[model samples]
Target: MYVVTGGEMHQIDRYTMDQLGLSEEILMENAGQAFVRHLLTSVSIDEKVIVLIGAGNNGGDGFVISRLLAEKGFQFEIWVVPPVERVKGTARFHMDIFKRCGYSFIEYEANSIGFRESLNTCSVIIDALLGTGVKGNLRKPYAYVIKAVNESEKRIISVDIPSGVPSSEGEAEVYGVIANETFTFQAPKLSAFVYPSALHFGEVHTLEIGIPKIAFTEVAPQRQLITEKRVRTTLAKRPADAHKGKAGRALIIGGTQEMTGAPVLTTDACLRAGAGLATMAIPACIHPIVTQKLTESTFMKLPDAEGEIRSDVLKEEISYIQYDGIAIGPGMGRNISKPIYEALRSFNGPVVIDADGLYHMSNELHRWCEEPRSGPTIITPHPGEMALLTGRTIKEVEEHRFEYTLDFAKKYQMYVVLKGPFTIVTTPVGEQWVNTTGNASLAKGGSGDVLTGMILALVLQQHSVIDAICNAVHIHGKLADKMIETHDIFSVKASDLIHSLPRVLRSYRY
Candidate 1:
């Protein structure tokens, strides 16, 4: 689905009313009624609901919901946080109609007898005090209401995004309501998919209001939420009589004596990701250990210098290897970056630059921008590596993750896989995909190594560069999701992801 920011969503809302010829009131009515349907299925009508109403259309949605509940013989209390007169426009119309229907509200005051009494009486809380337009910290009566709702220990359902969660950029207020569920209208807010604020949105349900499909198409949000179906469709179908040579060859070049496991993990993931042939080239000193751990894949022991791969050894051995795709980094140490760059600078097939490989590229990004590669080069960088590449603080890159990644890819004419809780994959032209399948299970060490290998395997299979990156990212994260079903997140290590790849791929088989 198309992922939009708050302003973009507002434009879609406006276009629905103005261009599609749907009245604003009918749209509001549609939103409220649609939400009420979902609410009814999840909660019982016998429970008492306290609707926290504000001065905006979000509050108007609450009024409509309260009116519907009253009609259904469901007991509910409407508490207007701001003065009733502060409500205006389409919202005012809904409020006036609700009052005309003989429904009255209790004016909520901070720590007041009536407020405390309402909190004590209600079994459910409907948070409609703030919507997509929340800015800064929780303020005034909204703050007081959020505090009371949180303290109530009642099941909370937030209208659109949770109150105190900013729909725009930046972190959510720690005081935001932690709802049992969030029923969002139209598309989900960008914050709904990202962190800090995402923690506040419990079970998110997107309700389709009366917005025309054309509005969404016209707005054309560059961001998208990756789904399983998308990854499944992007994968290449192997023939019944397929041979090892036909599948594709993937080369993983990295590993010092100290960090030998990193490259082994990459090789393990490469073959598991469906590569026909996988090779791991590490320092000669570590070959004995890696050989024992990895039996199925071939190994190339580059000449060692101080227990690290010598740059000259890589240059000499690379000429002999005939691989379809290369994944460089993982544990390549700082010494071999020159040869890694030299190898990538001339090669034609898809190359995944990651780990220490990116550390070197950070120094030569200016050169890369001037003389771009003809073939695809995918860079997988966590926030720390990205900070080194862009010369920005880690916090700066984290705050504007999408924007910074898009800029880097566009400027250098390469695809960038910015790794995080929500992994963002962007092409040089500005199209982006955010994979929402991962959990905290992937935060452990060597996760990116496995991901690099997966991307290499897909790219070697001749999938489009963008398709390969997106599919690999989705599958990698999806494996983590599957792991957490039967195992704890803390116990899901990088090797576990490799072990689970077959299960993930089996579900996608036709």
Candidate 2:
């Protein structure tokens, strides 16, 4: 599904109106009726429902809803925020029709008894006051109304989006209507997936506004939301005659005396993610401790130098390991090492550099980005690591996630999984996908390692690298999403995600 900024949405809307010959009046009618259709089925509508209408196209949508409700003999009141004469164009057309149907508008007074009583008595608020055209913070009139409605404790069904919330991601405003549900048109706005903005929209359902899919042909590398069906189709089943080697081979190269459990979790998660064979190459000192937790994975016991592996020595050994994929940087410390780059130089198959391994890559990023190599390199980095890689603040990385992630992916010519609540999976090219799964339950430490393992396992399975990365990300978050369904969300741990992988993985089986 397309998740676009306000400009992109307007371009598509313009394309539909000018090229496709679809009228704005027709689109408005379709939007309002589509919302009503969804609302009738999803919510119980009773008398005393109030429609808060503004002066823009969104209010026009509200007027259409008012006319349809009255035509259906439903009792509702319409409160127009702007002077009725100010509502021009298609919106005025709808308002005229609503008034022609013997309906009248309620006057607006910010602190009137009727306004407060109407908000207090209403069972639901149909918020069509603002749409994607919102700019910066809302004006006093709209802000006051939104604040009042939010304080009313009524179920809010916002039209297109909650009034006062911008359509783009990273909307910094908090003074928007807190809708119980939003009936967005055509595609979900980008803000719906981003945090802070995402919090205002409770449950969002996209309503079709008659915009054709082909109208969205102009993607300066289009951004899309990852859906379950996309992941299902990306998944492939191994042949019946497949053996351990044919299925996939994954080598996890990381672990130290101090951070012992990181690589163990990655190895176990790799196996659970369907890696036919997983090998743990850890410092020989910690191999005994790691061995107890890993039985199926083969071990490459490397000689230790003060609790850390001798990367210079192990560079030769890593070259000999026959594997389809390698996952590096689980428990590896912050210091950059030769073996880390050597594995990148040596391995021809996919390599997932994550966790502390990302730190090593961050140190010598020029070599990785400029040098021509044999196979695909995927890096799973959290915000802080990504900040180092991009030379930007963590705040900058979080605010401009898509921009920085896409720029870094294209510049480095590698796949970057910018891990967050809504993880972004970017390709070497410009294409990017925002994962729609996962929640705060996946916020625990060590979750990235688990995701890194799943990513390696998928690439080793011989699937498209982009699809594999996206699949891994979706399922990683989905583990948390599905776990919270039966168990307490707060009870979730990163290890629990690995243990509960089957719960979500079973549904994605080809």
Candidate 3:
């Protein structure tokens, strides 16, 4: 589903009414009726509904909803925070109609204690204070009314987005109404999925307000909500005659003396992700440890110097093995290793760099991506590591994740996965896929390694680089969510996620 910003939604509304020839008043009626229907379905009509409306079109919507409810014998109170004189255009028409129907409307002023008293008396409050067009910090009567309503212990439902919440960035900058439910028009906004604002949005339901499909299609939003239907449509089923060799082979290179578990997790996750064969190359010292952890895959014991794989052994391993994709990093120590650097330079396959490998690459990571023989490469970096690699502060990266991820992918000509709350996968062509499935349960150690392995496995399976990253990100988060559903997030380990991958994949079967 397309995620529109406030501006885009406005354009969509205009296009729907002007180009599609849909009457504005008819659209308003549908919106009001849809909202009233949602309210009737979600809550009791017997409960007193106090609507706090602004002086604009949003208020017009509330007025219509109030009129519909009053006509249906549903007891309700309408409090126009701004006086009826302040209402303009279509809003004025609706206000006049409501007055004609003998529905009493209160014109609240700055010092009206009655507004607060009414809010307190109502079982549910409908906040239509401000619409998507609201910009910056709210001021005056609207802000005061929002604050008052929030203080009231009533179940609040917001029209469109929550009042005072920015629909684009998901930031509630100043005094936003927290609604128990938000009935948005058209489609879900980006803010509803993004962060802090996502928390305040509570349970959101989109009510179709008669916006023409052509309008939205013409305005094609760059951002989208990742739904199960999209995932199911994109995933390809295996051919009946497919063989093990055709399924693809993946190699994971990492794990030093003290961090044997990292490579094990990556290798195991790759196998669970359906790689026909998965192998790991670790420092010879930890070979025995990693081998003991998983007997399903092969292991390569690279020559070790100072208990870490050195660059000298890279040529030997690259020559002996031929794999479809490689996953590097994940507990690979930062110290200079000649064999490791050699393998990084010599390997000619899709590469997924994560954990310590990204740390080691640092400024040189971009250079490696620019290399002629480097196949479709993907760097999975959390905020700190991305900051280190790009020489930008963690704060800078977090603030402009979309821009940075896109820029870095284009500059390096490779896919980039900037992992965080909404794990973003940016392709070289500047397309971005934001995976919304994951949760805080994945904030544990070695979780990134598991993701790296999953991506590498998918890439080796001959999926497009973008598809591989997107599928891996979705599956990784889905597994974490599954784990959380079964056990407490605090108690779930990264290893548990690796164990649960098969079950998650099985459930995704169409």
Candidate 4:
């Protein structure tokens, strides 16, 4: 589904009206009716509904809802933030219709007698004071009204978004109504995804407001919310006649003596992700630990320098391994940074670089960007790691995550998966995808290692590089979601995600 910004939504709306010949009145009417339908179905009928109106299209929606509530014999009272005569155009038309329907309304001013009574008596408050057009902080009487609504402790259902949230980005105003539910038109706004602003829009419901489908097609939304159906379609179907060799072969290279579990998790995840065979190449010191823990995977002992992979290990192994894909990092300490780069520069197969492997490439990102390679390379970095690679503060990395990912991917000519609540994947050419699945359950050690393994297996299975990365991200998070359904979200382990893969994959399979 498309995730539109305020400007994008406005362009689509204009296209709907100008090119498609859809009248604004018809669209407003549809929006109002949709809001009423959702409100009536989602909330209790016993509670009195108070519809708050503004001077714009959102208020026009409230006007429509007020009239519909009267027609349906539901108890609702309308209140406008601005004077009644200020409501113009399509909104005025709706207000006239509401008046003709025999419904009464009161214009509210800060600390007015009627406003205070309405604030105190209403059980359900519908906030339509603003739409996606909100500008800075709330001002004057509008701010006072919003504060009153929040202070009243009434259940709020906002139209489009919470009134004081700027549609562009960031948090809602301190005075903005903390909605219990938000009914948005067409697509979800960007504010609904980004934090602070996102928190204010509690339980969003995207209602179809009769905008032509062609409008969306013409607009071509750049941002999208990942859905289960879409992710399921991206999954490659398993052939009944397939053999181990045909499935794919993945080589995992990482693990220091003390951090042996990292490569172990990666290799295990590769097997669970359907890699036909997985080989773990690590320092000789950690080979015993990896071998003892991972019976399914073959182990190759690389030269070690104080329990870390030797800087020359990749140089020695490059000619020997015939794997379809390689996963680097995980627990490989910083000692052998040169061989990690060697593996990256030399490997012709898809490479997934994570953990310390990313740190090794931190300073030489420009070199990696310019180097010629046979297959796609993906770098998975959390915010701190990304900061190291970009030479930016952790705060800067987190704040401008989307921009940073796009720039790094486009500049370095590599794919980047910046993992977080909404993991963002950007391609070398700047194509972006935001994963909306998963939860806090994935915020654990070894999660990124598992992700590397999953991505390596998919790439080896011949899925397109972009599709491979996206599929791995979605499946990685989806497993966490599935586990949360049956287990405590807080107690979820990285290994739990690996264990849940069988069940998660089964659900996605036809």
Candidate 5:
């Protein structure tokens, strides 16, 4: 699904009203009615409900919901937070009609005892507060309301996004209503798929508010949700008589004597991701230990210098001729970055630069980022690595992840996988995909190693570099999501994801 920022969504809303001939009032009616329908199915009419109305068009939705609930014979309260006069435009029209229907509303005050009592008595709270217009932190009044509503511990159904949650990604750290469920109109806010705000939105139900597909414009939106359907379609189908050689050969090069497990985990995930042939290029000293842990995949014993692979070992033309894709940097340790760069500077194939591999690349930006490459390059970097590559503070990169990632990818002509919550996959051409799979369980060790291997394997199997990376990212996260269903997030380790790959991948294969 295409994701939109608040401003982009507003453009879509305006385009529908202006170009598609769906007026503001017509759209508001459709939105409110759609929300009400979902509301009826989710909560009982006999329950004591309260619709907290704000001052925007969101208030308009609340007023329509209030009128419909009253007509259904439900005893509900309409509590307007801002003064009734502050409501204007389409919302004011709805408020007038609701009052004409003989239903009065209570004027809610911050820290009001009456409001607190109403919250305590109500079973369901209809949060029509700030909606998508919220920017930065919440004001004192709305923050107070959000805190009180949260303390009430009532079943909260947010209108559109939860109040105080920014519709833009990476801006969800502000105070917001923690709703049990949220009924968003049209497309979901970009922030809905992104976290800490994702925590605020429980089960999100996107209700169409009469906006046609054409309203999103002739061109498809650049940012999108990496969905299961997209991943399923992008995945390659094995033939009836498939052979290992045709599946693709993946090379994982990294691992010092001290960090041997990182490369081992990468090899495990690469093979599990269905790479026909897998090879780990590790320091000769660690080969004995890695071979014991990894039995199925073969190994290349690179010459070791101080327990790390010397850069001169893999710089020859013959070294990478047999492999379709190469992944560097899991457990590569810190010292061999220059040698890593020398190897990267010579080779020409689909290469995944990860872990300390990126740490190495961070030093040679002029050589790697500025120079042209004969083949595709994929970099999987967490926020810290991304900051190192871009020379920005970690906070700056986190705050503007979309911008920084896209800019880096476009400028360097490479596929950029900025790993974190809601992992973003940005192509060299500016297209972006945000994967919603995976949980906090992935925050532990060895997660990125597994993801790095998965990317390399899928890129060799799938035709489109963009599709392959996105599918790998989605499945990697989806595996973690599945693990949390039967096991706790804390208990999930990197190896567990490798073990669960078949069950998760089986569901995707036709």
Candidate 6:
């Protein structure tokens, strides 16, 4: 599940060969055989194959694959860019073997019309023109050949990393080859998860290319892809004798007169995520509206001076509510009322501060973190909100998500969920988890409210803060993915994600 950069992967390959005593040729053979297996099984081999080889080990892989295909009686054409003579080391060795076996090779001369004709005639194209080691913009015949192959409208398969991709940042700065399927070695690369580069890597298959297990263990990656197996193992199982109160109770405080749906979404998500009981403390005026919206959850009407929760009433209710966990600030407007501050100062349980609540805390962040009642606080902030809290711009926060998240968590002694493309959940214990779930469909309104509810539900259920956040995040994305299985992501609504939660939870065996 570790995601390494292109450079790290190259070092890992070398270490495996030198330290572990694994032969480089055997690793090449393993990679070639695995790719051939996937190609033969996943796609048809009845049509002619046109493989474009460069002058590196990636091209060596292409030569081995071409040999395997020819041995299997498959018709194919090998096109060596810069000619076979320019290929060196392992690539040169393989090229010699191919020539001796009576395989025809086409020397790519910068302006060969036959090259274009062969490309157009082939049914499939193998892109071994570049590997992960490629950096900066491509030049000359390589770029021209890549552009020509892309324009051919044939099924393309890229070996290792796609040609012209930067590999780690996931950005396609220049021209990048689009492959129908990409066969990566060892583990999934960083480029496979990031934006524009991810688009070109279709149906990625991570093949085990004869690297020792110890190498992976020694080089731990910072980012990871969340899988169903990982989620299944992390989920806690309920005992048959468990009771409702034993599962834990959660109290959510949010919602004003106009944004009554925010607290409702949070409470509903909590219930669906298996909270034993859920309670909401809303403004006295909006209490009836929230009650009507959510029949399953209990509601308390807090003092409201101008259609918002009065801080005085928050203090009064904090002593009476015997909830295990509390979630605040979903739709609570940014009103600097004295009552709101008083109530925040009084609550003394594990609290999840989000949305406008996070905005309010930015000014007196140190006091909020060092308060006597602050027991296990978690702040969920998007890039903009994070910038407000950390005194940085949105661009700065995005570029240094890890550093900022760690700094904020350590400073406040709290858990911080930095929400974005890859949500970073950092704990005060110096451990960080990057959630690789969810999708663009979650960009809709009320989605954060849903996440807040899910996290509160797990925390109230007595799960560790880290585990709760991790589980909630995984389920949040799984629900969206499940919905996308039947509905379009653009059309998927926030409420649809809430409704799918029960089914998604039930799908988990634990």
CA lDDT of each prediction against the hidden true structure: 0.85, 0.84, 0.80, 0.82, 0.86, 0.80
* RMSD values, in order shown: 2.0, 2.0, 2.8, 2.2, 2.2, 3.3
Query: Candidate 6 deviates by what RMSD?
Result: 3.3
lDDT value, residue 131 of candidate 4:
80
* Model 2 whole-model lDDT (C-alpha atoms): 0.84
Cα deviation of 250, candidate 6, in Å: 1.2
In TM-score terms, candidate 2 sits at: 0.95
Question: How accurate locally is residue 273 in candidate 3, as Cα lDDT from 0 to 100?
Answer: 83
On the 0 to 100 scale, the lDDT of residue 151 in model 4 is: 84
Q: CA shift at 405, candidate 6, in angstroms?
A: 4.8
Q: List pairs with backbone clashes in candidate 2.
A: none
Tens-digit lDDT track for model 2 on 194-280?
767888888989888778878877433278888899999988578889999897988898888988999989999999888999999
TM-score for each predicted model, relative to the true structure:
0.95, 0.95, 0.91, 0.94, 0.94, 0.88
- lDDT digits (tens) for residues 1-510 of candidate 1: 777888888888788778888888998899899999999997898899989888998988988988888888888888888877788988899998998999888876532557967788989899988878777777777777788788888899999989888775556244688898999987878887666778888988989887878988887778887888887788877789889988988888889878989999998988988899988878889988999998999988788788887767766666634877888888988965455555667778788999998987787777788888777889999999999998899888877787889899999998999999889998999998988878888999999999998998888776788888888999898899999999997999999999989988788765
The parts of candidate 4 lying over 4 Å away from their true place are 110-117, 170-175
* Sliding window of 10 residues with minimal summed lDDT for model 4: 166-175
- The total number of steric clashes, by the backbone 3 Å criterion, in model 6 comes to 1
Ranking by TM-score: 2, 1, 5, 4, 3, 6
1 versus 3: better TM-score goes to = 1
| lDDT (C-alpha) at residue 461 in model 5 | 82
Better of 1 and 6 by TM-score: 1
